[model samples]
Target: MSSNLTAHHYGITVADLDRAIEFYRDVLGLDVLDRFAVSGPAFADAVGVDGATGGFAHLDAGSARVELVEYEPEGDDADAGAVNRPGATHLGLAVEDVEAFHEGLPSDIETISDPRTTESGATILFVRDPEGNLIELIEA
Candidate 1:
């Protein structure tokens, strides 16, 4: 029962769908496969929100698909907090050169750390998207 699981996509809730789409589509080079609107109880239960009504984008980043969700924000506007909190998850993207990719990132992007090599010899760095969702770039 444990062998058949295949990851299809990673869902990230964004504050602005258009902005996220532009970043992932233009900046990261992921193609926009679909754009949809989701709402009602099913969406709410899946997202753990009272009423989730917003746009969704399916992005294909070569070998992976990322689902970008723009949920109607509930609470007051605040910065995304610590990544060590429970339920915090981040996406790791494979790149050819971690150092070059880090240098090529936009100036405004909130980069957490510079590219560094791990014990396993994987070069990686962390950065936050426009909505403050963490993303890790690992050298391929």
Candidate 2:
């Protein structure tokens, strides 16, 4: 028997669910689909964390769904790894115009670089979310 897999959603652990939701909705233009809180045994068992509790938000990123979660009694802060680091991952978003998108970004947004064309003919750039999670914007 073979296991079947399909893309459902991408999840990011955030320090603040509310702020993350605002950034995704207002800054990146993703639509807010749903928001809720979870806890107790079922949540703990699913996540493999004891006494787990958190808030979750699902955002619509065009064809993709992005999930943001903030856990209570939060863990220690760790550096959000660079793209070159082992085990580092980033969510790539398709944009209509990379250059224009970069230009309109808030001054406080931390961008890895200005929009640049890839050898494959796509324009792309990296930006960090308010909590330092990396996100890639690509125009093909």
Candidate 3:
């Protein structure tokens, strides 16, 4: 029998590693799990890039994780237009309170959807990240 393919985290391609780290670590409250440069040829084969450079960091947000991929532009798989892709979708992360999250959202963020009470009583708000990635702030 095959083991279930668990989605451990969402991988994001970043133009700037340090800046992205600051955003996810400082701006957001995600805990940094590990930050270091990847080594060995296995990663290169896995990412389809031979010899990868730059730093990578993993952040733990709730049960899911966020992987920040920073490459030196040699043979990176990530394009700069991750959020701009035609069929790209946002990463929905649940928050304890939507109202707090809504209030926490930066003013510069273009609110996709305002906080609204769902029929189930939960509140939901949609907002875009600095990278223009859509995020659904769901409240329990």
Q: Which one is best on TM-score?
A: 2
Across 8-125, the per-residue lDDT of candidate 2 in tens digits comes to: 8999999989899889998899999999999999988898888999899999987769999999768888778789988788999999999999999999999999999989999999
Top lDDT: which candidate number?
Answer: 2
Estimate TM-scores for all models. 0.83, 0.95, 0.76
Point out the higher-scoring one by TM-score: 1 or 3.
1
lDDT of 1 by residue, 1-140 (tens): 56887788898878789999998877676899999997889988887878768788999866768999777845455546677887778888899998988888788878888999999999989888888888888984
**Local distance difference test, candidate 1:** 0.83
| Over 4 Å off, model 3 | 74-86, 118-121
Candidate that beats the other on lDDT, 1 or 3, i.e. the better one: 1
Cα lDDT, all candidates = 0.83, 0.92, 0.74
What range of 10 consecutive residues in model 1 has the weakest lDDT sum? 73-82
Show the colliding residue pairs in model 2: none
How high is the lDDT of residue 110 in model 3?
A: 70
Q: Per model, how many backbone clashes are there? A: 0, 0, 0
For candidate 2, the clash count comes to 0
Model 2, which residues run further than 4 Å from truth? none
